[model samples]
Target: MGTMEAPILTVNNLNKQFGSGCDQCSNPADRRLDKNYCPACGTVYSCQNITFDLHPGEVLGIVGESGSGKSTLMRCLYFDQEVTSGEAYLGPYKEGRSNLFRESSQQKRYIRNHLMGKVYQNPVLGLRMNFSSIGNIAEKMIAAGNRNVAAMEARGSELLERVHIPVYRMKEAPKNFSGGMQQRVQIAKALSNHPPILLLDEVTTGLDLSVQANVLDLIKHLQRELSISILLVSHDLGVIRMLANRTMVMLDGRVVEQGLTDQILEDPHHAYTQQLVHSLL
Candidate 1:
């Protein structure tokens, strides 16, 4: 994606916390804590001043170890978890004028259903285990106000096929599928609405190496075919290297580094980032 084009999505100063702040942690500039936690107040800062932009038809990867707030950031953007404070703008929503975080619940639901789709790390969170795979895809379409059963069925089968899930198995429930298949079904469901922006939160985290490669290849092909903008979250630098054009590195609830994927890999500036790259070597 070119830098001249406006970003498809923009996030500013996003923050999420698990507990109320005490006197010691009230002011961000003066707060003292263990990593992201405030010892005296027991408040955990899951995401702190997180900011980034996702360009059209671009894959922006967020990489960090566990507890680095990468997943929490995805949750906030997808509206699965509320942000403590932040502003997000979607280029296609209100001509990029509204702050998505401040929208009403009804509007937020509208955006979630129509403007974006998310594939969670866990299939259970994204799909109904007991429902047929196609039914799960239809559920998302229904949320977006689709009423024609025939159209949904056709679309569901098309998507599942695109993800390499056999058309014959579309009637099966996700619980009966293998871990990789479950994730593929989740991807199909997320793409049901043909959303412009996709939030992928560690979609290949628990799969075998071969399965992970298969899923990643599917994502790469689909992204190019559909020209969909993706925000991909993972702890694996290798995954980021394969799929991301730009990369953001998070640490201790904050963004420690970000740049072109190649530049960061070759000349990492942060100490933590250096360690991560060294491990890859």
Candidate 2:
């Protein structure tokens, strides 16, 4: 990303806590740092003072091990969960100045409908197993206010093809499809509105290596085709390296390090990140 291109999304002082704070749990130092557990009251702090900026058309990867806050952060940004504090501003909203965290429910719906798309780790989370694969795609289009059946189905069919699902299989239920195929359907549906930003959470986590490669290749192609920004969260550093321009290393509910994907992999600054890099060797 060019230095001159303003960030499309900026997250500042983000925090997600599971329990109400108590006097014993309140620590000023903890407020400024990442602490997943309160020493005094045992509250779970899922995310702590996390901040980052995603430039337009860039793929920002969040990498971490299981139990790290990568998925939690993604969930917060996409509004699948609530944030305890801080602000996330989407530059494209309100002429590049709306704080998404401060948006009303109706306005948040508008932002979700118009600006972003999300693909979850589980295909079931993103796709309706009982619905026809094509219908799953149209569901998003309909939610976005497209009422014309012909146009919606046509658009769905077009996206199915784009994701490498055979157009003939569009009428089949995703429940009957292979996991890889189901994921493809999820991707097609996510792209229904051509969102500027896509949030992907472990889209290829369970697939076989070859299948993962195919899915990854498709994503790479779509990034080029659509020029969309992506916030990709995965435990796999290989996936992050392949997809992200910038990578943030997360550990125990916070970004411990962040830099160019290549640089981060080649020369990790944090001990946790170093351990991660070595483990991949």
Candidate number achieving the greatest lDDT relative to the actual structure: 1
Cα RMSDs, all models: 0.7, 1.7
lDDT of 1 by residue, 70-138 (tens): 999999998989999999999999999999999999999999999898998999999999999999999
> Between which residue pairs do clashes occur in model 1?
none
Q: Note the residue pairs that clash in candidate 2.
A: 91-96
- Name the 10 consecutive residues with the lowest summed lDDT in model 1: 24-33
Residue 264, candidate 1: C-alpha displacement in angstroms:
0.6
Give candidate 2's TM-score: 0.96
Give the C-alpha miss distance for residue 222 in model 1, angstroms.
Answer: 0.5
Runs in model 2 lying further than 4 Å from the true structure = 30-35
